[model samples]
Target chain A: MYLAKIFVTHKKSILDPQGEAIKNALHRLDYEAVENVSQGKYFETTLNCDSEDKAKQITDSICDSLLANPNMETYRFEIEKVGD
Target chain B: MKFAVISFPGSNCDYDMYYAIKDILKEPVEMVSCDTESLDGFDAVLIPGGFSYGDYLRSGAIAKFAKVMPALIKFANLGKPVLGVCNGFQILTEVGLLPGSLQNNRDMQFISEYEPLIVQNNKTIFTNEYEKAESIMIPIAHGEGNYYCNETELESLKQNHQIIFTYENNPNGSVSNIAGITNKNGNVMGMMPHPERAVEKILGSEDGVRLFTSILKSFKGGILVE
Candidate 1:
C-alpha cells in the first residue's frame, strides 16, 4: 500500500479572511513575532496501489479534480510506501 | 416561454425561483432535479441559490459534478439564457461556465441584506430591461460572495462588456465591485445576489422583476408587452 499526504492552501494572490482573523487573534494575544498566518487543509489517504508512483498520480488527480479549486487554491502532495 | 429551475440537493431557493417565474413573471416554469441529465423544452434555465451538497470541500465544488451540469453546459452553448444566483453562481464558476471564484466576505461574516446594484451593461438579454448605469436594489444573502479573478480575466471581462452588475457601495469586497457577470456570449449569467427574493414588493424590492422580464422579452424576439 501507499500513503498520500496532501496540503491545500489559498493562492498567494487571493485574500484569506479566516487566516487574517486568526492572525489578528494571535496579535491580540501578544504573539508579536508572528507577522502572518495563512490557513489551509491537510488530507492523509492510504491507497491500494502497490507502487508509490501510481499512488502519487492518483492523489494528484484527486487534488486537481476535487480537493482543490484551482481558481482560488493550490495543492501539493507527498507519497510514501506503506506496508501491505 | 418555459423556464426550468434546477433543484440541486440542498437547494433552498429553488421554489422561490419557480414562484418568481410562474406567478410573478407569468410564465411557465418547472422544477428540474440536478440528478437529471436532460434539459430539453426549456427556454431558459435558472440555477437557484443554496448550500448544494452541503457545500462540502468548497462551495459549488461537488454540485458542479452533478448529472445535470453537462446538460446545462450544452444548453448554455446553444445560446440559451442561463441564470445562476448565489450558490448557483459559485457552481457556474466551479464548472467553468463562468469565470472567477467566490471567497468568504472580507469581514468574514454571513451577510443577508438588501443592497443597491448598478447596471453596467444593459445590452444583454439578462439586463436589457434596465438602463445603462441604472441603480437597482436587490437582496444578497451569502457568506462567500466576494468574487475574485486574475487580472487578465478581469481585463477580458471588462473588454467584452461581460460585467453586467456592480454593487453600488461594494458590499462584499468583490473585485471591481462586481456583483454579477455574464459569459462572453452574454447568454449565461452568474450573480451573487438573489433576484428571486426581491421579485415581490412585499418581500422587499420589486426591481428584480426586470431581469426576468428581460429574458422573456428576448425570447419573444425583443417585443415586451409590459
Candidate 2:
C-alpha cells in the first residue's frame, strides 16, 4: 500500500479572502509580526498500488483531474510506501 | 422551445429557473437530475444556483463530475445555449465550459441583495434583448462570486467581447468588475447574478425577463419582439 499526502492552495496571483480574514483576526489579537496567511486544503489517501512510481502517477492524475482547479489553485503531493 | 434546468443535489434554484421559463416566459421547461446520462431533446440547458455536493471540496468542484456533465459539454459544443447562474457559474468554470473561476467575495460575507448591472455586450444570444451599455437591476446572492482569471485571459475576453455584464458598483471585487461572461463561441454564459429571481415585477424587478426572452427568441428563429 502507498499513502499519498496532498496539499491544494490558491495560486499566489489569486486573492485568498478567507485567509485574509483570518490574518486580520490574528492581527487584532496582537500577532503583528504575522505578515500573511494563505488558506488551502489537505488530503491523505491510501492506494493499493504495486510500486511507489505507480502510486505517484495515480495521485498526480487525481490531483489534476479532481483535487485541484488549475485556473485558481495549485497542488502538490507526496507518496510513500506504507505496506508490502 | 424546451429548456432543461439541471438539478444537482442541493440545488436550491432549479425550481426558480423552471418557474421563470414555464410561467413567466411561457415556454416549456423540465427539471433534469444531475445523474442523467444524456441531455438529448433539450433546446437549452440552465444550471441553477446552489450548494452542489454541499459545496464540499469547493463550489462546483465535485459537482463537475456529475454524469450529466458530459452531455452538457456536448450540448454546449453544438452551439446550444447553456446558462449557468451562481453556483452554476462556478460549475461551468470547473467543468471547463467557461473560463475563469469564482473566488470568495473580498468581504467574505454571504451577500444577498439587488445590485445594478451594466449590459456590457448585448450581442450574444443571452443578452441580445438588452441594449448595449444598458443598466439593469439583478439580485446577486453568493459568497464566492469574485471572478478571477489570468491577465492574458482578461485581455482576450475584452478583445472577444465575451464580457456580457459588469457590476455598476463592483460589489465583490471581481476582476474588471465582471458580473458575467460568455465563452468564445458566445453560446455558453456564466454569471453570478440570479436572473431567475428578478423575472417578475412582483418579485421586485422585471429586468431579468428580457434575458430569458432573448433565449426564447433565439429558439423561435425570430427577431427580438420587445
Tell me each candidate's TM-score.
Answer: 0.97, 0.97
Q: Least lDDT summed over 10 consecutive residues: which range in candidate 2 chain A?
A: A75-84
True lDDT of residue A84, candidate 1? 58
- Give the CAPRI rating of model 2: high
For model 1, the stretches where C-alpha displacement exceeds 4 angstroms are: B222-226
Model 2 lDDT tens row, B54-133: 99888999998999988999999988999999999999999999998998999999999999999999888898889999
Q: What is the model-wide C-alpha lDDT for candidate 1?
A: 0.92
Clash pairs, candidate 2, are none
TM-score of chain A of each: 0.95, 0.96
lDDT of candidate model 2 versus the reference? 0.93
The residue-by-residue lDDT of candidate 2 on A37-64, one tens digit each, is 9999999999998988999999999999
DockQ, candidate no. 2: 0.88
Q: Report the C-alpha lDDT of model 1 over A1-84, residue by residue, as the tens digit.
A: 988999999998888998998999999999999988999999999999877778988998999989999989999888888785
